[model samples]
Target: MKQVNALTVAAAVAGALSLAAVTAATPAMAKSVKCYGIAKAGQNDCGNKAGTHSCSGQSKVDYDGGDWKGVASAAACAEMGGQTKPFKGMNPKKKSS
Candidate 1:
């Protein structure tokens, strides 16, 4: 009977800890937003607007305007010169020699 009680307590504690971890992570997840025109070649988080690929990390050019990645916030995305909407060309911020 004592062993059964101890096992029950351990399971309850473990469940509570897992719930606490997920709850603590929720706010950070809520803050994330997709920012286009900022991804480097092969570093995008998901599909591009051009629809040539349907997976992450498939971009063929640096700072492709159609690709995006998750940033901390809209403000952060703008601060980094990224756009909230996808575009049809290379990032305007890219410099040419």
Candidate 2:
């Protein structure tokens, strides 16, 4: 019983340390990324830009540009083509995604 208790405590401490290390090593969530647009206008507006036209929401990662909309998650925005200049008012279905 004593050995088991000691082992359990050691394991718990090790696990906690591991978790802390992971948290420390993990990079801060990037503010933005260079993503692609899957639609002209849906939850996001990647079509505002020229050339891109329609994208799969799968573009490159960008750390800068525009403000973030809480409505769109980083992952979701990433799928659309990074971030864009913060939008105002509700987003309407202009071109369809």
Candidate 3:
């Protein structure tokens, strides 16, 4: 039986680590609850998910209910004058194709 070379094992490990790093850098799909009408301008937890922009810091307006912010607690959402239920923004429009 041929024993694995130490250098080959190290190279494989290093390659795996770098791949994990790249995957980790991308945002994970968190179990975040939707908090509506709470996002400050350019401070949303994620985009409208309507292809507006990438997640986080994408909202262009403040308190845009259409643009929900992710939160861990419903209490915190209410404290921030946000609704647990989602709503339409000031200007409702069709999502782009």
- Evaluate residue 87 in candidate 2 and report its C-alpha lDDT on the 0 to 100 scale: 38
Which candidate achieves the best TM-score against the true structure?
A: 1
* Model 3 agreement with the true structure over 1-97: per-residue lDDT tens digits: 2355877888899999999997885554365677877777787777774557777888887777667777767887777677777676642332212
lDDT tens readout by residue for model 1, 1-97: 9999999999999999999998997787567798998888898988888898989899888888889988898899999899999988888886422
What candidate 2 gets wrong by more than 4 Å, as runs, is 28-97
TM-score of 1: 0.65
Give the least accurate 10-residue stretch of model 3, judged by summed lDDT. Answer: 88-97
Least accurate 10 contiguous residues by lDDT in model 1: 88-97
Candidate 1: residue 76 lDDT (0-100): 94
lDDT of 2 by residue, 25-74 (tens): 44533333433323323333233343333442322323213222232455
Candidate 3 achieves a global lDDT of: 0.70
Q: Please list the residue runs of candidate 1 whose C-alpha ends up more than 4 Å from where it truly belongs after superposition.
A: 1-31
Better of 1 and 2 by lDDT: 1
Query: What TM-score, computed on C-alpha atoms, does each candidate reach?
Result: 0.65, 0.29, 0.53
Sort order, lDDT high to low: 1, 3, 2
